[model samples]
Target chain A: MGVFGHKTVSMTAKIRLYVDHPLGDGQTVPLDRDQAHYLFGVMRQQEGADVALFNGRDGEWLAQVTQAGKRGGELTCVRQTRPLQMPPDLWLLFAPIKKARTDFIVEKAAEMGAAKIIPVQTEYTNSERIRQDRLQAHAVEAAEQCGGTYVPEVTDLQRLDRLLADWPSTRRLMFCDEAEAGAARALGAAPRGPWAILIGPEGGFSVTERAKLHGLPFAHVVSLGPRILRADTAAVAALTVWQQALGDWDGPQSD
Target chain B: MGVFGHKTVSMTAKIRLYVDHPLGDGQTVPLDRDQAHYLFGVMRQQEGADVALFNGRDGEWLAQVTQAGKRGGELTCVRQTRPLQMPPDLWLLFAPIKKARTDFIVEKAAEMGAAKIIPVQTEYTNSERIRQDRLQAHAVEAAEQCGGTYVPEVTDLQRLDRLLADWPSTRRLMFCDEAEAGAARALGAAPRGPWAILIGPEGGFSVTERAKLHGLPFAHVVSLGPRILRADTAAVAALTVWQQALGDWDGPQSD
Candidate 1:
């Protein structure tokens, strides 16, 4: 989303709905039961009403409702009114925390412009199970709340060891290693590259995990400074540091 | 707070302790009931036990328990062990949140190397009452948890409007103004001086509050970036942004 707000004359609010359809003008998009119930029953959106829609690729568009049924709804894409606000080229990876904290991590990550969010299971991680859909919804809601046109895709929970198994060749990993002793490396000079920041759980990465990460060729071991931050704090801290250093946080971001 | 853990030490078992008393060699420091209970009851420190004491001044020192009691304790300051770890000149000025979050702010600030933590009352802020002692204890515990040698002083709650009135002449205020929108002003490029990072509350700083802040000549209006950050995340984000930009996160600290 651009920093400047744009005014749209949305009335009888089309209830900005998301459908699993290739968005285009005159293309009819089927609303899933959940979205239908939300728009028709919950929002009381009537047939022939106008609503906004957007996919990650399609810019925001105003759609006209074609059908409103008891259990379903359908709309035809009208026109793209706003360009998709591409998220920052940053990935947020972290061990899953307790329920609320995990949700908080996703919410903050989405609000902070993370292009993708990954939940990793570490050696000392207490929670391996993740509510991926719930987290994904949280991210969507965060984007909506922040007036962002882009929503970060939340990946299914994966083991840290496995994700590092055949690591992507191009993406660089910015390991937020808290137990830096006190290296005090400057974030000012962080190298520019495709970057992902990994935050450990509350107990922190086990020695074995840290050793594996430290030895990786593509990993850049960095400190969020000297503190033994809680896992969530480390996530936000690492994101901020990375954004200030390498992410599209400074200077003009190219759309 | 040295840049590296390179200044070698003849390794010894170290336990960072908090004493309300000002520390000095040959001075018999008496632990209050709380400290005594924490030392003897919780930590199981016995008479003649060795421990380290730091009072935000006087380098860390070896201390031996002279008397042990459930309600009271006494210790004799021994030789100075590690030199005082002076925190970077950073002040955390934040709008007070709910009880737990407010405590969280003070605790994280202390651990993250803040020299002082100030709680300010904002217009949209609902809570005016604060438990200064409890908040102070949280800071102490965070310092202990993070192995910090300095415990930031937690000042009593003051009105936000009032504190900004006498905005220090020498200190530069990095206002984490959400109003900066998507303007990517690299905080790293901003002038670094005696600094403080300001974070607003849940409802955010009021319009009048923002205008007053923007009007200040010494204030540097900077965005933590796109997406609306919750107050707590905003606090950590602002701090990390500062440490990466200006604070001691990367600079050399000499003994």
Candidate 2:
């Protein structure tokens, strides 16, 4: 393995897998039936193939397929390729929209480095509940595709009022308010230790909800632009804005 | 009409429609078969219903439905609600990805105020051609949904090399390079004139293509972040970064 071992592993491995097991040198990781089918049935990987693995805690590891079978498979870690790079302590709190768009939001949030994803139910939110497991799987797949080691947890849907009732005092909320369109308020001046971005639904926040959020000391209401963006587009744009202004985009890679 | 006349029209009209004809005072606009079906059959809009209309030229108009039928309809403009709010002189040049994701990019680009959209084919670009008409329709739909008065033109697929060969010298290019991940370079200092953002395909630009981009005088290579973003996510993020830095996000609504 060269220098940081990233070059060697990246050159040898074409597929990145996320697992729940620990990653270290000479550790054997058994693949479940679904993973076996994906490796053997879909991807056609056989024994002795190099696979990159990450378990969200121990960084990334280079593993070799030792026992490949139709029903199950096993891989032994050869070396550590990368260390875990934790994202900024940023949470994305948004009113869930439609199914595909909600999934898109979760996946983009994971790729854009939102440490936690929470689905909030506002008065105008169209979605009653979200499939947390499915959203979590999307987050994992997004991390796998985007070469991310950490997967943001997708929490179950909670009421917006309730979430704000016991809001953490230390965390600042960047609320993307549609009513604030054309306003020049940005997140550039906001202090950025811990932040959460709140995006409303398609119909936007109710008048009372907006008043409550505006009254909160931690909420920094900002406009996305002149146009009123859809809930999903607003989520991605909010995350991008937060990442650029207050997240890790300004510094070198910590890992 | 209450200052901008936006409040009265928006409060009375629940549906916004994009038309091809010019919109002005007392102007009668005819609707096509598809539009008529959408208004009558799908949305159940009846005669005398108020519908907001924008034709990409004249500002927005509050129109009252005069004839509503299954195959055709007509609307008479009552008054101009808002002026034609033009986006900044910015274009989005991106290599097309999957179909749905490509649609998503165009939609978000329109919502984020890209003046034009161009699909470029790079060395590693997977798509050979894109349906320009379909993408244009998606832009129109996005504008309609996002309450935008302007719709960005979706150009047909063009080769990256040829486009760069005759690239306009006045328009600056924000090149998002995957290899430059974790770089601290940003668009904060860039000027606010004519500009464009270039996003590579999933496989990214080949070495030769990247070198060529880096060699261009107008190109400014920038990194999205540490984690690699997909083409769609990169497009939105790049737009957000550019808008926040040098686009219309900081200014008041300009009509």
Candidate 3:
């Protein structure tokens, strides 16, 4: 929890912050054990030191530590630094891969403007064990690194069959079907509605999975390219393709 | 060498081969020490045993072990098995990243259908040290894993300036500009040509680098999406976009 627990704050390129709430009349905000360790032990924030703070919905604000300790720390929230970060409306749905590659996928997914990251287990998937906390933590860090206001939600891994069984009516699924030849131009040209890009696993979607996906009226079986791509590569590729084709551009689009 | 040295052959399905050639064919196709060790010690093939061989351009052939030792190993090329695996004609050009990510980039690049993998040193590139041979081996292994006939050649790290200075006349540079808003259609609508997808490193292109690249007549600045992609992600994303766009799309057309 050392570096991982650093509070996401809003500050200028170079600015100090205090965390005592202005509404609370300079009363120091209590730092949890994990947060205290991170600030004092890891980040080495001392008393009267400045740091940034931001609630997900609220604009970023500066804070300063009034008390420092190994196990306990306190800070005071001060003036505002910057406005809250607004994220794009992109959702990424990908078949899960191995643990390490899966983590990598989740991390990149969050950093890449995905409002939601959904994991679908396809027919060919072998490994099923997943630590949701680990994946969610990776997403949080990735969001912070990219300076995004919204952290993409890491939904539990669900079977493709079940997820598609009750597929949403409003959200269009840009199914990245490698088996689908070069019919992408036609499908891509007419894309509409809220979109999510679906990438298969390394072994690729089973014939049944592909067919199930094909039957969906909302599904756009988009192709990644001429050559076969690894599942993780396909995920990133599909996201890029979908973003260009229908994702929010220049931050948030009119949609 | 243990797992990678075995020349994995891909048939439409499983193949049964016969090895019959003059024991000594006066071929200087020397097996490296590693290959010899794997063939003689690891594989434990006898003096007369059937093995498969394919040299990308050359048709697949059956080869029999005539000599077996760690220092020297020889096999006589016999009857043909099947035609060689012809890979798609696509090249991947990416600026170097940290070592692990760079290796990941090369491995995934080969597995994903890159005919050639070139690592370029960009203006913001922090990695100056690269082992060409080691990286090349990674490409070979990736090809083997994906059952690809053509092992992409991982060229020595070339300066971006030097590479553009002598850019190929016929090859279309599909520049994957991260700052680009988005591709018209990721890969789907990418213009056709002898294509190369260029991915910049983490810190991104310097002003000078960007200007030089933009000035190139053959460069087509395309986007992956709205997000700020990492270097490795950008490489795969760019390649995917290229594959979708001008690649071998034999799908049903809109018309």
* TM-score of candidate 2 relative to the true fold: 0.94
Q: What docking class should model 3 receive?
A: acceptable
Worst lDDT run of 10 residues, candidate 2 chain A, spans A1-10
Q: Rate the local accuracy (lDDT) of all candidates.
A: 0.74, 0.83, 0.65
**What lDDT tens digits, residue by residue, belong to model 3 across residues B103-167?**
98998887667789898888767788789999988886665455455677889989889988888
DockQ of each: 0.22, 0.39, 0.27
Model 1 chain B is weakest, by summed lDDT over 10 consecutive residues, at: B2-11
List model 2 lDDT by residue over A62-129, tens digit each.
89999999999999999988889888999999877778888999998998899999999988776797
Compute the interface RMSD for each candidate structure. Answer: 7.1, 6.7, 7.2
Q: Compute each candidate's TM-score over C-alphas.
A: 0.77, 0.94, 0.77
iRMS of candidate 3, Å? 7.2
lDDT of 3 by residue, A117-204 (tens): 8887777666686677788878876665554545678888888788878877887888766556665655547645677778776665
Identify the runs in model 2 with alpha carbons over 4 angstroms from their true place.
Answer: A1-9, A181-186, A252-255, B1-9, B181-186, B252-255
RMSD of 2: 3.8
Where does candidate 3 stray beyond 4 Å?
A1-31, A45-56, A59-68, A72-91, B1-54, B59-91, B169-172, B182-191, B249-255
Q: Estimate candidate 1's alpha-carbon lDDT, on a 0 to 1 scale.
A: 0.74
Residue B29, model 3: Cα distance from true site in angstroms: 8.5
lDDT of 1 at A106: 94
